[model samples]
Target: MKRLSTLLLTASITASVMATGCIQPTGDAVSDAIPTAQDVRVNLPDSAGEAPAALGEVSEYYAMTRGITRGFNAGAGFVLVLVHAIVQMPPTTVDGNTYTWGPGSDPLDPADYRLTVIDNLDGTYDWSLDGKSKFDPNAEFLTAVSGLAVAGDEAHRGSGEFTLNFTNMKALDPIEHNDDGDGTITVIYDLENRDGTAASLEMHIDGTDENGQAVVADYAYAENQDGSGDFQFSLPADVDENGSALEDIILRSRWMADGSGRGDARISGGDAGDEVVEASQCWSTSFRTVYETSTHPEILPEAGDVSECAFADQDLPELPGV
Candidate 1:
């Protein structure tokens, strides 16, 4: 289970820290039955931090909408082939442009699964699956593109860049609470050297969470020549109750080769005041998990409490391709 979570994180950084769920019944187990993503529009009430409402407000919303750009990659592998094969849909057809499986059993359309792969012939391809009645109304419409090719290995056999796009995702059945609204998220993965490792990636989100408050963010990650990388993010000012810009929030961190890293965050406005906080984390390279961490080392006055730094302490499982 720990390794599964780590593999999910390796898919992209956005997946690492974002938590998705909906408001539900009492116990945690009971509520998780439905995989619902949170509507980030609903944020902390301004009263929670009566002090100028700048840093506090920005931090609260950033924390709320952490997982807006996930879910699409939940089935990242060759999902179309796997899904059809699992259901025993054979009599499959494969051509340069398309792949069709099944004459599915009754109630299931014979061509229950059909995939269209368009080879751009430029070291890239566009693939799409329209899974009508697959999971829900929109489950089958997932689309992806390979921006570049990666060198294949014995463990993992695939080439090219990886990118996917999902829109209006109401089909996911995410529940809303406290007036949070729904929105769309896009993910782009850039493989720096075609070595099957992502050199950098970016996620753009423009949507409202459950709170109905407008939320927007641009997050980017890049690798250094030394095998280390950094994650940086920026949040546009959210609207106040009176419809005015709250404050902008910015965060950046650099992780070393050993998975140890340092980072900082700040909230600023039109010269109202600025709140800054610094953080660091150390991970056990052997175990492939975070072992220790700290936030707000400088103790800048009125920086408020630094948001908790999180590290995955789970054992990483060997995914399909190492």
Candidate 2:
């Protein structure tokens, strides 16, 4: 998926506003309550560059898992575009503790969408993206997206917790431009304490997939401060049409600072009639498979000694509440 340029546009506008002191502090509580874009943004890892010939042939499993990583990043990028659009734009009006942003003075403009940020006055802020209903000719603004962001200390700015609701985004957008699946994604992060060697990000997703199938998944990623990190996601049974005997499937990948990594996949309902199937493959710095093993020999036979693995079982990152 192509990356959205809205974030860059927001950054430029924010910088211009700050430089001109257009929205300077005026003892306005609601204006002061608006959080910066960084407070709510979750930055995902970028895709690895092309593998060099020196690493030999790339492992099929590595390529497959890498694709999944890219897909997750792309999905996240799409959701954040709206967040950036709302948080970075200057509010058009402030009433009591609520700040509003819209196209201009025209209420019946074709744009029709507006954003509101309300200060809870207790370190947490409520926000919503609303638009006029297409079905009703005289409808008021209806919330299409909503969320809450807990304000952190000066050092962290915005880090404790964040939640985003995309259930109505696509259905309620005047132009039907939203691509988010029907669901909510919650993120809990610690910027100060969780930086460097202890860096970590945990996200919980409860919603439907592209096929409108119910899905609940957990994503966890951690960086070792040395450019090495681990990524893992789990899909419970019946998430897809994987058959009646479906069970949870967990895929985990860990990479070193130099780009060498290993991917492990476990399938509970395999082709062999519900028997658990497990596979592990290790790739070189160039992404070439150097070692591979599978319990189902016909599916993914062993290719090299276990000793060839650069990482052991203990190196895998653990998922929360799994």
* lDDT of candidates 1 onward, in order: 0.34, 0.57
Q: Write the per-residue lDDT of candidate 1 for residues 70-97, one digit (tens) a residue.
A: 3222323333223222223221444553
The parts of candidate 1 lying over 4 Å away from their true place are 1-91, 101-114, 133-169, 172-181, 192-198, 224-227, 235-248, 269-299, 302-322
Candidate 2 lDDT, 149-183, residue by residue in tens: 55544433444444555565444442333444677
Q: Kindly provide the TM-score of model 2 when superposed on the true structure, using C-alpha atoms.
A: 0.69
Q: TM-scores of all models?
A: 0.44, 0.69
The deviation in Å at residue 11 for candidate 2 is 13
Off by over 4 Å in 2: 1-55, 103-111, 120-123, 138-140, 152-157, 160-166, 174-181, 193-197, 209-212, 235-248, 314-322
Full-model lDDT, candidate 1: 0.34
Check candidate 2 and list the clashing pairs.
none
Question: lDDT score of model 2?
Answer: 0.57
